[model samples]
Target: MSISKNLPMLSILAFLGLWQGLAFYLHSPLLPSPETVARIFWQHCQSGELPYHLGMTLLRLIVSFAISMLLGCSIGIALGRNEKLNAFFDNWLVIFLNVPALVTIILCYVWFGLTESAAILAVILNKVPNVIVTLREGTRALDKDLLNMAKCYGFSHTKTLRHVILPQLHPFLMSATRSGLALIWKIILMVELLGRSNGMGYQLHLFFQWFDIASILAYTVAFVGVIQIFEFAVLKPLDNLALKWR
Candidate 1:
């Protein structure tokens, strides 16, 4: 079991070794060695720039995620529970889901004039439909016998949802969350690239102008490291804890 787990880390080290060998052979400024990138990444950390900008990006991710999940789950549950509401919103949901995220982001910026609200709103708009679709399916697939049992036991709406509905919906919610994080972070970077003054994306843009591949890679490594830590330290733990009842 330990060997299986360590295999991924070994593969990463092997890949980095290959990368280092290539950088040594090419000897190009454009493709700095991994050690060079790590040195630069350390410099940025010491300067405090990386921490501040990365924090900004993470904050946006949290805010937009909260908004989309709450609103989407509510809307999805309502639609799923009501045949008429589902029919009315079905096409609109399809429209939102099918719309390109870049188009939505650009439109929000145009209409809202490149403000923070616009950035967050664009992210929420892009993400909400996906959450809704997942949750709506979960709601639809809910066991009728379980619901009827709850009804027979005089379970209040809130109680029924908490103990019965939500427990069954856990898988769908987890699915939405995993996909949402994967998607929202990339879009957040794009949002920052297009408008924001500070973030990993904005910093990367500056590096791009100078053709500083090392700085770009440094930022990429630092930010992606943070994200990986968050996944392992936060998301994975929460997932395990939440699903432990099963």
Candidate 2:
């Protein structure tokens, strides 16, 4: 096999080796060996507990991600296109952007109670501002010359949006998507930890109380692996497909 393909596996093995060595040297429960973590991971998978919690976290992530993206893109495009509106809303964007995510999560829970809606809203409020900032810049950076050409061709609004606007925004869209995936999951974890009854975050919190280092590492590895799989399988392919037009 090529070095590139083998490199990742080799790197992982090397990491496990290092972890095992460190665990042996420390001889502490605080740092478990990779093998110990793997055993706990497999046991959790068999018990179905890990999957259920993962699913709950995944659901919250998806719902919040979709809402943030939709609202962010719409408002960002509108503000980018209209100077007066942008000026009016600019402070609002800045305010939201600067607000601490933890504060937002706490506020949502206080105002709306510890419901799922509150959790989801906390995520959306935290994420939408960032998406708006990225997309607004992308919108402003759009090539006016291409826009004129589209206009000269008498492209309908829908056609222009699909064929002209979206393609130009692809880079920004992808940027928002990547960042959103990273940021939203963290916020979801915090939300679950603070208020929710079940999720990877809650499980992690439980393990933390028990000082179950192996279980903590196991769940963390599982979630990070899933995120990596998504980036490689879904995001990368979609990005490549989008770029083919260029």
TM-score to native of every candidate shown: 0.94, 0.95
Badly placed stretches (over 4 Å) of model 2 are 1-6
- Expressed as tens digits, the lDDT of each residue in 193-216 for candidate 1 is 999998877888899999999999
Which lDDT values do the candidates have, in the order given?
0.92, 0.95
Number of backbone collisions per candidate: 0, 0
Instruction: Show the lowest summed lDDT stretch of 10 residues, model 1.
Output: 222-231
> What is the TM-score of candidate 1?
0.94
True lDDT of residue 126, candidate 2: 98
Tell me the lDDT of candidate 1: 0.92
lDDT: which candidate is best?
2
lDDT of 2 by residue, 1-246 (tens): 698889999998898899999999999989988888999999999999999999999999999999999999999988888899999999999999999999999999999999999999999999999999999999999999999999999999899989999999999999999999999999999999999999998999999999998999999998999999999999999999999867
Task: State the displacement of the C-alpha of residue 241, model 2, in Å, after optimal TM-score superposition.
Answer: 1.0
For model 2, give the 10-residue run with minimal summed lDDT. Answer: 237-246
lDDT of 1 at 49: 94
- Model 2's number of clashes is 0
